[model samples]
Target: MQKSPLTSTGEALLRGQLQTLKTSERQRLRHVLEEARAHGDLKENAEYHAAKEEQGLLEAKISYIESQLQSCTVIDTSKLNTDKAVFGAIVTLENIETEDKSTYQFVGEAETDMEQNKISYRSPVAQACIGQEVGDTVSVDTPSGQIEYEIMDIRYS
Candidate 1:
C-alpha cells in the first residue's frame, strides 16, 4: 500500500484513538454484548441486536485505524525548511483579487480542521502552494473559478 504522509501530531492522535479502542472500547462493547445476551431470545432481542451491530462498527473502526497507522509516514515539522511552502509548513497567503490574508497549516487528511485553519496537503490550495516560496503567486482552479494567491510567508514549528 502507498504510504500516507502525516504530521507527528496527527500520528500520535491516531495512535491514541487506536489505544482507546483496543483497551477501553473493545472491553466495554464486549461487556454490553454479554449483558444483552443474558436477557434475551436470539431472534427478537433488540438490545442484543443493537449491541452486536455496535460491536461490528467498533471492530471496523479499530481495523481501519490500525491500517492507517501501518501505512502512514510520520513527518516531523520542526526539521523541515521554512523557505518554501511544504507539508507541515504554516503558510500565509494573500488573495490576489480580494487582498484578504489567511494563514493555514498544511497537515495530513486525518488532521485537517478548517475551523482551526489546518488544511490537508492534498487540498487544492496546499497543492498549489507546495514547493512555492514567498512572493510566488499560485493559481488554483475551483468550482466557482480560478483563484490566485500570493505566498507571503512560510514557517515551520
Candidate 2:
C-alpha cells in the first residue's frame, strides 16, 4: 500500500493513544476479565464474554494504529514555508459575499479534526487554497453552492 502523509502532531497523538491502550487499557481489561472469571462458569458468564469481546476490539484497534503508523510519512509542520497556503499551513480567509472570517489548518488526513479547524489537505477548501498567496481569491464548490474566499494570511507552525 502507498504510504499516507501525516503531520508530526498527528503522529505524536497516535503514539500517545497507542501507549495508553497498551498500558492502562490493557491492564484495566485484564483486571476486569479476572474479576469476571471468578464470578462463574466460562460458558454462562456474561461479564467474561463481554470482556473477551472488548479485548478483541481493543487488539484490533491496536493493530490498526500500528499499521497506520508504519504506513505514514510524518511531516513536521514547523519547517514549512509560510508564504503560500500549502499542506500544514494555517490559512485565514474572508468570505467574498458575507465578509465572514475563518481560520483553518490544512493538514494530512490523520489530523483532520473539524472541531480544531484542521481540515484534510485533500479537502475542497484546502485544494482551492493550495499554491495561493494572501489576497488570492479561491472558489470552492460545496453542496449548497460555490463559495468564494480571499486568502487573508498563511502561517506554518
Candidate 3:
C-alpha cells in the first residue's frame, strides 16, 4: 500500500493511540474476558459472549491503527513554506459570499478533524488550496454547491 504523508504531530498522535490501545486497552480486554469466562458456560453466557465480541473489535482497531502507522510518512511542518498552502500548512480563508473567516490545518487522513478545523489534504477545500498562495481565490465543489474562498494567510508550525 502507498504510504500517506502525515505531519509529525499527527504521526505522534497515531503512535500514541496505538500504544494506548496495545497496552492499556489490550490489558483491560484480557481481564474482562477472564472475568467473563469465570462466570459461566460458553454457550449461553451473555457476559462471555459480549466480552469476546468486544475483544474482536479491540483487536481489529489495533490492527487498523498499526496498518496506518506502518504506511505513514512523517512530515516536519517547521521548515515548510508559509506563503502558499500545502500539506501541514494552516490556511485562513475568507468566504466570498458570507465574509466569514475560517482556519484549517491541512493534515493527513488519520488526523482530519472537522470540529477542530483540521482537514485532510485529500479533501476538496485542501485540494483546491494546494499550490495556491495568499490572496488567491479558489473554489471547491461541495455537495451543496461550489463555494469560493480567498486565501487570507498561510502559516506553518
Which candidate leads in lDDT? 2
Across 1-157, the per-residue lDDT of candidate 1 in tens digits comes to: 8888999988889999999999999999889988988996869989999988998999999999888888889999989856888999999999999999999999988778999899999999999999999999999899999999999999998
- Model 2 Cα lDDT, one tens digit per residue, 73-126: 998989985688888899999999999999999887866899999999999999
Model 2 residue-pair collision total: 0
Q: Point out where model 3 deviates above 4 Å.
A: none
Please count the clashing residue pairs in each candidate, in the order shown: 0, 0, 0
Which regions of candidate 2 are displaced past 4 Å?
Answer: none
Q: How far out, in Å, is residue 121 in model 3?
A: 0.5
lDDT of 3 by residue, 61-154 (tens): 9899888888999899998756778899999999999999999999999888899899999999999999999999999999999999999999
Error of 3 at 91 (Å): 0.4
Clashing pairs in 1: none
| Candidate 3 weakest lDDT stretch, 10 residues | 78-87
Candidate 1: misplaced stretches above 4 Å?
none
TM-scores across all candidates? 0.90, 0.95, 0.95
lDDT of 3: 0.92
